[model samples]
Target: MDGDVENAPLTDEQVSDQWKRLADLINKLQARTDTKDEFNARPGSSLTGDDAWSPPFHVSHAVNACIVAGADHLHACKTLVVDAHSLHVAAPASLIRGSLENMAAAFWMLHPTSRAERVTRCLRWQMVNAKNARRALAPLDLKDPASYDERIATILEVAQRHPEIDIAAVKRGFTSTAAVTYADEHSGAALGVLLPWQLCSGFAHGFTWANLAFSERVEIPTADPDVFSVRFSTDLTRALYLVWAATNLTESVLKLHAQRSTPQY
Candidate 1:
């Protein structure tokens, strides 16, 4: 079926159930190593291969962000939580590329003032709304599959604009290198700088691994519990998730209907 019919309209209650189901699927995917390998195989490219598919990790991340921010902004709404460790999320290249570029642009625009912070905040806001927009998705009546072709074309346009984001420069400033690293536990690699000791003192001390193979490990520097010699932080992960989710949600929505409708928030 086409994307829209496949994603039939869910009443508010059904939407909640579907959202929960998606989250559970993500959690199960995370915990299954065999599933990850199966997903990574180019099944369609190989005639003998089983055509198994996995939800893109970025999409799951985006789902989580919508749940998180929506819970926060919608006020008194129930929160969604998933076991990240067990979720087999393979990071989508599209989200990684788009987020890196956005970050890079913001990094270049950074200044030691509230003005820069405001811009950063706005970018983050755009990302969150775009990602969790399902509750706000407008009505669409697809006459036929081709009716949504224009939306597909727009997706191509937006994607083509993303590679222009310069993640390399942002990494150089943070990690002092253009080379990004993949944590063994990550479905995809992360590119960012290590936090300086002076700046790391104020953060939380515990973290859990996702995507890659690693024991459930938590490292707190004896002197600076909040800082790490090597690792991704929950804060960073959450922010990245927000950006990824927004991007994918936006992309997915564009492909599902005849026209793009911004939420009325």
Candidate 2:
């Protein structure tokens, strides 16, 4: 049986083809939206009234966002694959890590209780963004005091509207590591995702261990009596792993959405 046979290793051409196929799938998925209108309009659909605030609706929306984000990262990886000679493995690996983290969060948020916590975390995130934007505009405001008044006002409004987020707590909760842990607790794929997350996180953070993995020594001969140039060539394995993981995560998100959308008759 085919299942009994061990799989052969993929050749370079086969890997390239897989990348192209993944890119195509991402493009198709990105064209879709998560609104009720789109879902109810599908052929043989039975959705009648709006379930906008329901758990399934919210879950579907989060999954759709995850799909779009995953597609973007997949496309980026595809571009890097096409230009393998100049590939910077860390760049796409970082993006892939981000996409996976988002997927994990989406899955984690699918539960009834987690949905409210997700909202709180979102508000906390927005608060951080607003604070950062205000700080960035602080200097510009010196040139024209009114230049960023509206922007500052908007940030303040958000802060006033939402219950104050404990900045330290929020920081602790929203880290990539924390997201992965949440996934491990809620999403079944966490065990598979943890190591990759750690590997990519090291790269993204410029850890010595991660950098060493990509480093290669190359010597360039000089015309002068005794001069030489040495440079490092990055291994493409990280990038390949990133692309593969992204494709799998995208497919998982799509399947989750499909299962959620199906009528429970």
Best by TM-score: 2
In candidate 1 the C-alpha lDDT for residue 198 amounts to 10
Model 1, residue 35: distance off in Å is: 4.0
Q: How do the residues 99-171 of candidate 1 rate in per-residue lDDT, one tens digit apiece? A: 3333222222221123222222223333334433422343343244443444434333433333532323212
| Alpha-carbon deviation at 72 in model 1, angstroms | 22
Candidate 2 per-residue lDDT, tens place, 1-265, comes to 0011116766777666665666666555545532334422132222111122222223344444555565666566666655454577477668777777776654544432333344444433334444566577667755464545554354344334335423344443345566566655544442256666776778789775765565565778989858877565564444655656555555555554454456545
C-alpha lDDT of candidate 2 relative to the true structure: 0.52
Error of 2 at 265 (Å): 4.4
Quick one: best lDDT, which candidate? 2
Off by over 4 Å in 2: 1-14, 33-66, 83-86, 111-173, 184-186, 214-231, 235-237, 260-265
Clashes of 2: 0
TM-score of each: 0.19, 0.59
TM-score quality measure for candidate 2: 0.59
